[model samples]
Target: MSNTQQLKDLTTQVRRDILRMVHKVNSGHPGGSLGCAEFFVSLYSDILDRKEGFDMDGIGEDLFFLSNGHISPVYYSVLARSGYFPVKELSTFRLINSRLQGHPTTHDNLPGIRIASGSLGQGMSVALGAAQTKKLNNDSHLIYSLHGDGELQEGQNWEAIMYAAGNKVDNIISTIDLNGQQIDGSTDTVLPMGSIKGKFEAFGWTVVEINEGNDIDAILKGMAEAKSKTGKGKPVCVLLKTVMGNGVDFMMHTHAWHGKAPNDEQLANGLVQNPETLGDY
Candidate 1:
């Protein structure tokens, strides 16, 4: 069993990692990365049935794909802390020739990253294909994927969504980081996506809503419920409502910080708000 306090502590630490990784490089996306800290921490720490080490062929264990790969800081941090690689490697984030890039890439052969994302709308297709492969091999383990709500603007997602449900890709759970704010502005201002839940249901999916995407308890329960809904002849979609830049008071509720790295003073302030719970890498 995973302890709530421990999960919370890990979240705080992951937030710290996101902030520091972005601040160090003076580049990379921090807003979405910060927003999804809780989900990433909970997924790695308590949700996915992971194996002992990393491999390209994940046969028996659950696999996770990040479609919105700009938020690579949180993903990299969680993978490292989960023992996929040395936590110290986080310092190389966005640095020249580093495995960690502005967006996740398989070119570096990063242990935890299975696919190169950030083009948007393509992750769903890749994940669906992987889920299908799992089924073919008779592996009962599930496949999990995360996408930015804004990425839905791409027409490819709808096609994938349609395909997943039409074929009954029941071994996958796809979660949307429904933080209303995207890069240019609020999703409504940039481009409003009407009723994600309704859309998924219309596409023939089992949908669940997590009202508090930042809360560890909510993520744990929501994910458990999502797991239960799988393999019932429909893919599961989780509408995770999150506040962009969740941990830092100054960064919350705005799209301005989406890809902007914090300055030294700003970084210090953010660090104060999320004091290190697990040691910084």
Candidate 2:
């Protein structure tokens, strides 16, 4: 990975990309995207033992799945910035026929996107398949996945959870963004998912809690620990605590911006806060 400062700078730039992409379309999700900027940056920049280019097979490289596909802005920004595709292509986000859809899909043949997401709760099962395949192939590579905390209410995740533990799918690490805020409202108010860690532990999976999901250093440290636990006997889950709409002062601490775009004035404010790092698309 790049130095800590470089990773931070990329994160700031990714935030800018998310804001601009959503503002340009007057649509899309920015809250979750902004909240996960640091994790995306850290993962693509340094963490993954990724190969030179993109391919669906992933063969010997680490694979990542975005269960909460509404956050395509963040995912696209990171993939583009990481050279999976042209950074300039980020300008076409959400436009008709654009590879960068509001939700990720494979039909577009977009690099770095393995499966369609956004239905919520199905990502764990997909990651498990990949992990199990890796193990069968005797490949040491790991599979990583991210899910929205609110998305866990889907029930399908729990089934996958039980399946992973029971089948010993230990080569995968799934991180849940515990931002607490979701589209409808705060997760606590909308649907309380009591004791996510306990639930995972009870299912026989190893758990790693990242208290500062928005911090590069903290995420790197926590993820490193999670990586070490792979190949043991159970899957690993990361309870990542993040803040919705991080970096943008107004967007923070609320679910209002979950799928809303910033207007001209709000966009100006957001850009000013993130500044220009690595230049705009």
Candidate 3:
């Protein structure tokens, strides 16, 4: 798993899984999920200091909360492939009574999911709470969370941002997927939040920017730096610049795929681009 090439291959396969998962049910978000493939693969395969099994309270292990839960395709794929569940369970995505809901839910007590997330802007608050809980328990493992750049429009996230800095939640690493696109057109068309790095710095966070987010090697290196910044008296924030629909040419650089699944032809096209690096689920 430490091999960068192996992780990149997994990233390609995760993209295949995202495309196929969304296309199978004609539901779910694919843009952000595709954009975050490298992050998820890099985190689970190379970065996280995790235990061998799943539990609600992840003591002595690093934790991850998907703030933008709509990207459940990537989350679910990585979790299953990483042994949180059977990889074949992915076929049940978005089906009634399935653990893989449109957005991740804990009602099924799905392994590797601590909080239900597609409700944008709440993940930071949840992740911060977990970070603080680790502090209270005298646990040194870091807490990680990902947020959509567009989701920053939510007032609750800003409040959480302020609280994290003010409370000195140094045991957490919050990464913003700065894809600049959301469900409704580009983020600028919706609401422009200027200078994310400046905002985080002004709020007293140590920020790291990963300009090449889709590259697994860059992610591993940048996340390592982010992890090293932990316990240094300030929370770390990684601004990961990514393409909305990264691996698929037709889907790239547009918000149309944000919440839309590819059609049969589009799915075939995307699969061709990604290839089945690791066998399909």
Give each model a TM-score.
0.99, 0.99, 0.98
Tell me the spans in candidate 1 whose CA falls farther than 4 Å from its real position. none
lDDT of 2 by residue, 97-161 (tens): 89998899998999999999988899999999988889888999999999999999999999999
lDDT of 1 by residue, 1-281 (tens): 68999999999999999999999989999999999999999999999999999899999999999999999999999999999989999999999999998899889899998999989999999999999999999999999999999999999999999999999999999999999987888889998888889999999999999999999999999999999999899999999999999999999999989999999999999999999988999
Q: Which segments of candidate 3 are over 4 A away from where they belong?
A: none
Ranking by lDDT: 1, 2, 3
The deviation in Å at residue 225 for candidate 1 is 0.6
| Candidate 2 local Cα displacement, residue 62, angstroms | 0.6
What is candidate 3's lDDT per residue for 163-273, written digit by digit as tens? Answer: 999999999999999999987788888888889999999999999999999998889889989988989989999999999899999988999999999999999999999
lDDT of each: 0.95, 0.94, 0.93
Each candidate's root-mean-square deviation in Å? 0.7, 0.7, 0.8
Better lDDT candidate (2, 3): 2
Task: Candidate 2: list runs displaced more than 4 Å.
Answer: none
